[model samples]
Target: MPNAIPTTELYLIAMAIIFCVPYLIWRLGRTDYFAPLVVVQIVTGILLGPGVLGAIFPDYYQFVFTKDVIQSLNGLAWWAVMLFVWLAGIELDLGEAWKQRRESAVTAGMALGMPLVFGSLAALALIQFPGWIGEKAQSWQFVLGIGMAAAVTALPILVLLMEKMDILRTPLGQRILRYASLDDIAIWAVLAVVVMDWARLERQAIFIAAFVPACFLFRRFMTRLPERDRWYIALIWLAVVSFGADWCGLHYMVGAFLAGVVMDHHWFDRDKLDTLRHNVLLVMMPVFFLSTGLRTSWEVGGAVVFLAAGFLLAMQILGKQAGVHLAGRLLGWKRGEASVIGWLLQTKALIEIIFATVLLDKGIITSATFTALLLMALASTMLTVPIVTPKLQRMRELISRDA
Candidate 1:
């Protein structure tokens, strides 16, 4: 016992391995086409977690991922996700969505509604089997939570993907962003409904009542502060809002998003905000992914987890494509437009994971269900570039040929 590595040393060693292994795999394997570095990191996390590597190497897993080390990692993961989610909220450009409200509403609604319906049906199937429903969830909660998870557009990741594809500055990409922005607001609002605690209704109501005035005053106050001072104040505000939401049983992540959503993006420099988001992902989000992987379970068996993942992924892709195609027809979109739009909307990486994390924390979904959704998210994201790139290329060739 005296010869054992100290907790601090082990924690540092674990962090080193967490970053190094995934970087090496991503670099050496050259999986940027199907599995990006972030996806590789998430898979590595699952492998390092109790289900995979821990199953094979019990002593090493126990030693490195000790209760203390995990606690340390979790604290890092918590703040990392909060910062990421907060940035996501601030990035939501509803003003643009409003300018294109007619098209945005129709596309966003069908895109969200169809997948939600499909995912809910899948949820219904899962609930009939044991180990799928959470201990505290009612039937409605579990169904709606899973449905919304399917409907998530992962606006941040979509932005990243569009940037890589060189379409981010194009008119089509801007249009896609408008539709996604509307869905982003709807996603979190529905989540608020799904996670609502009737027992704490009085407290939640009070929090909402207080938050409106506080938000207004906070915005006014922030506008009066110098830029440097504003950043510091924002962190303080993030903490206060997160605490209030958690206290009212709505959860801290919801509050974090709300905190950022109400604040004007112009309050900070756009370049600085972008850099901060990039740095957070580079430095801290891997920790969140690892912590998430640690929560994965196979009590219902690994095969079942994978099967459920495949089913949900299929439903998500098909349903989203169906919905977007329907919208395309209704809105008189040209051919090939819907395919590109559908694939882009299907990119659900970080947001879906965050949403599922909240659901798991609230006991609205069990670990087995969370694992399935995690796998579904990873698979869904991996498919985006490969599927969309060809569609985009073919469309370009067709246009050029016709010209």
Candidate 2:
């Protein structure tokens, strides 16, 4: 039988419209204020959810964003995350990072190792936090998970921050970008293992390992074809590879990411890549971000909420700084340079936030902790834009003086 139209559709419908409106304003070149756009989405989501407005109008809330509907929303959220991750992977040309192997390794180490260790340790202090939101868990596990979430680097945000600060062309900026790129690679691979869609992971690892080699091998075999035809044929094969990755359990995004990386060394028209990105911005990302904000809860917070938020932010800052200092010493790099790298990697994003939620659903963590963790990520990304650029500039001053 054809399914009846869900009455709960309206709440979701409201969510989409409210969240996208600000993003649209930002996109139309009307707002220099970008962070507020994301904040509004998060706030509006809380305002309309059962946590607040729904409490006053029980029937109205249930009629729209019912349990079933919310469940569906949650499912779609993860899918969007997977796609986001895939797109994230596609953004960096992994092979290029491989060429700068030692620097890249050092950069990745300083970027991830610091925040991770500190965040986890700090999280241990938070494991016993009491809360009724999210599926709850022991303090230690909760802290460990929260620690990872706080330490994460949001690659997309870092790129935006770079352009916003007009530092993209600077020597230091290039190095940070390279560091950010390396962080993206490590984070994505870590996510694959931790988030646990094994089928996807297995297939994804194979594609990533095989992609560069297979592409070159195919290039040699297709040597007889006209250059134009050979390239397009390979693109088709790339799409097939993307499809294969999707089918294997990773999501089509991992496939798309692999496809993009494989094509990086190819001499494609620059306009084509721009067009592809344009289309994605026009449609997919808006949908993804809007959908994410719609699920945020504003009313479910309390006094401890502030504590959770503050702790996470502090950890992100101090932990990353410590990481940079440690890594710089180990790699025989200067303290200032290492600090710049640390600041750059302090931002978190959709991947970590979404992963925590996934863990919450499985009862591995409590709702209070998860909610606190999500806030930690939002704060990490939102705050880094203001913190990193200025701090790095100061570092440069110190460096020039030392020189």
Best candidate, lDDT: 1
What's the distance in Å from true for residue 154, model 2? 1.1
TM-scores, all candidates, are: 0.98, 0.70
- Residue-by-residue lDDT tens digits, candidate 1, 178-258: 988888899999999999888999999999999999998999999999999999999999999999999998989999999
Supply every candidate's count of residue pairs whose N, Cα or C atoms clash at under 3 angstroms. Answer: 0, 14
Model 1 bad stretches (over 4 Å): 1-3
Q: What is the Å distance of residue 294 in model 1 from its true position?
A: 0.5
Q: Provide the lDDT at 5 for model 2.
A: 57
**Residue lDDT tens for model 2, 1-403:** 4225554655457456655665665567544443535443444444555545667788766666655666666555444554455445556755656777787777677667777777777676765444532343444445555656666776655666666777767876776767777766665455444433453567657766776687687657666666567557755765676567656554454455455554443444556544554454444444455444444443446567667777878877887888767767877886567655676677665555555655565455665665666677666666665666677778778788988
